[model samples]
Target: MTRLLNEEIIKKLVTMHDANRIIDQTFQGFGNKTVINPSKVSLDLGETGGYPFHEGFVNAMPAYIGDMDLAGIKWVSGIAGERREAGLPYISAMILLLDPRMGEFISVMEGTYISNLRTGAQTANSLKYLGFKDKVSIGMYGAGEQARFQLEAIADLYEITELRVWNHRRETAEIYANEMKQYVSGETIICNPEEGEKAAQAEILITVTNAQEPILLREWIKPGTVVFPMGSFQEVDDDLILSVDKIIVDHPDQALNRGALKKLHKEGRVTEENIFTTLGQLAIGAVEMPNFQEEIIMCIPIGTGAMDVSIAGHVYKRALEQGLGENYSFINYN
Candidate 1:
């Protein structure tokens, strides 16, 4: 029998806290050599004109965790400009879990929420391990769905003193600020062009935009600041990338291929030598945090299959225990 869980059921079964723990455990498994994650496979569709000339892509991510005895693959789709034109999310994904022992399909669940929560948890975990201990202000470069999840997860873990937000569209920033006021007790500032520096000055800065060019500059960042560029495209310049005190990534290979540093990687401005350590190493105590005089640290996470499968496995168990999903047979026993 296969359990089929929808987004609502997955949401009911999993919380931000659960996602955080699951991601931590997944990283621990990676450190302990108990998780197998392959390079993600993606198929790009060039100007398909499906939604009036929009580009899109389909990606497949597969992983197995020995400790949890779980295996799964996430199939994800992304269509550019869908949100603005059609009011649809930019990305949609689903996960198929298989029994690790017999290779039998066990369950299927929505992966969009899992991706959001796990991505947020990854940042929260990075902040917990690598950020300043004192309460600090947070700055968001993009006010979108991913930014909302990042704020929610971070709020659950840290005591935020203030929030500063800027977006390409002021209306989006205003909407995000209004909605996030309930979560942030401190003041929320909607930044203007002149006041954009305020967001960059925050003790913790997070960039979640799908920009092709850099939006954050090295001059704007301050000492003792931690930055997270969480988008798939470039959001920070090479100067900022080269000037950071240390660079930490979820996975070296994936990070090098995408996010803020991809251009730098291609230009040979940054390499493996520039990376201080991976999040897994920090999670499992494989490497010590650098004791550097420079106070700026940047962490980048390109969402991984391990994170997806780990969260999926956790949600699957909880859904079964709580009787939240419908069960259907995938194979016939004759």
Candidate 2:
């Protein structure tokens, strides 16, 4: 019966990351789950219609986490129109956590913050597994919130000496570079990617844009580089889709079907032949890393509800102990 807000969620996420103790237990998800995400429908202020929406997968994400045995549900409903409204986000989410013992509603809060954190967590994990430890340079495509979070997560995970950032917009890239300078306290290589910067410099490359087509052109990536295609799979070039020495996903069953790799497979551009391994398999020690070659390795995160709930449940338990939140009755039965 306690309520937590977005700001509260952000605090918890930050706290968890700072402590390096966020428990992530993800359930099964679709591999290359496809649905149209067009925005043709429109709606009046009072009346509702013209949602101008297209299909995107809605998933049931459930998980039990640590510290109070947290469990919750996250429904990832995709609709692309919110960006234009300047009110809602491209992705809208609703999450509910219940008392596992009694099945009573415990909390409901905005989910976008947590979603981005999950991506950030996975991105940090990717860097830990594939990135060169001594490399100080980070090349990022897409200067959005996720980009910021990726940098934050990386700094938390590594002693990033400096950064190199790129975005299509010069102003955005410059601003990002400058902001990063404040954080690094050292020389930074931040700028609009020098035509083909992806493959040129960064020891670690991250893509988090919304481009419908490729931004990280295959030829642009450097040899032995670890690439994180955090944005839509559609934005990564076909060459990258086919050329990588290792392709990893949080879950292959879902990654193979609905992940970017699956999208390529559907386009007849890539097949099972392209995917060398998945993170889950790697976590289970089913596969091993290859020699450092001029190879591009990309890992995709398909926001899992289980991970979300597990994290939230733990956060909620902590919040209650801190004497946070107010009790309210969501449903009144006389």
Candidate 3:
């Protein structure tokens, strides 16, 4: 029995990102079967001053890494509210990793950071499989932490010659571009509002904004563009989705519902059957990746508790081996 802290989780997560071996290994090793109890609503639990909203999710997810000979349960709570003046995130969570063999509480940590990284990595991994490794014209749609991580991961994979970034606000986009210019190899170009699509016609496109409606139109997407849409949950327009000939996702089951693809499916424009392949299936050689030509290939991510648990499982082992976090009891009584 042991406990891993947020500091430990964050530390190990960063190390894992650098360790492409671990990212690649975990990307290929883990699998989860999730059953989500549809979101339940409760009124007036707490004050979210200045006009706020709250949405909650409860899920029981069990997962395994057959090669690692490890399995765990990651039960999570998703409560996201509009940002209050309290200076906190809009979404927060908790994850408990329990050992299936002994039923011990392996770890407990704040899940917000983990959720962002793993979800971001899921897209990064997809890009590794489907994106152009040699090309470098990069365009990112959002300028959040997820956006930063996605760009970092992309730079790791491709020879980014230009990083064209756009957000709704000019000042914010400039700040993000300036911050990025310090680290990445290429120039960080910021686009004005009207020029978003004009800037999007790069070798690679990453849409990570909190966009409710599709910001990048279907007709505007250039050929051979690989769009890694990070935050589009409800869905995108029919034209944008149907216009793309190929689709790839992290988990078909998860993305097929709460992601852009499902919204496309519901519109009678596309279905689960339309999914060409998934990253995991392709990684495992379960599905074959076709010749990715000059087409707009899309990878829509649906966040999963399994992604959290698997990453936690990896961190628990590596951090312990390196003598990282404090030890605590994880006991279960029958």
Q: Which has the greatest TM-score?
A: 1
The residue-level lDDT of candidate 3 at 166 comes to 83
lDDT of each: 0.84, 0.60, 0.64
Ten residues in sequence with the least summed lDDT for candidate 1: 45-54
Models 1 onward score TM values of: 0.93, 0.79, 0.83
Kindly give the stretch of ten consecutive residues in candidate 3 with the minimal lDDT sum.
33-42
lDDT of 1 by residue, 125-185 (tens): 7776673464668999999999999988888787778999999888889999999887787
Question: What value does the lDDT take at residue 242 in candidate 3?
Answer: 78
Candidate 1 residue runs with Cα over 4 Å from true position: 47-54, 81-84, 291-293
lDDT of 3 by residue, 183-271 (tens): 46766778997787766767677777666677777777777777776664532456878788788766666666554765666666677
Q: Which has the higher TM-score value, candidate number 1 or candidate number 3? A: 1
The model with the greater lDDT, 2 or 3, is 3
Instruction: Give per-residue lDDT, candidate 3, residue 22.
Output: 47
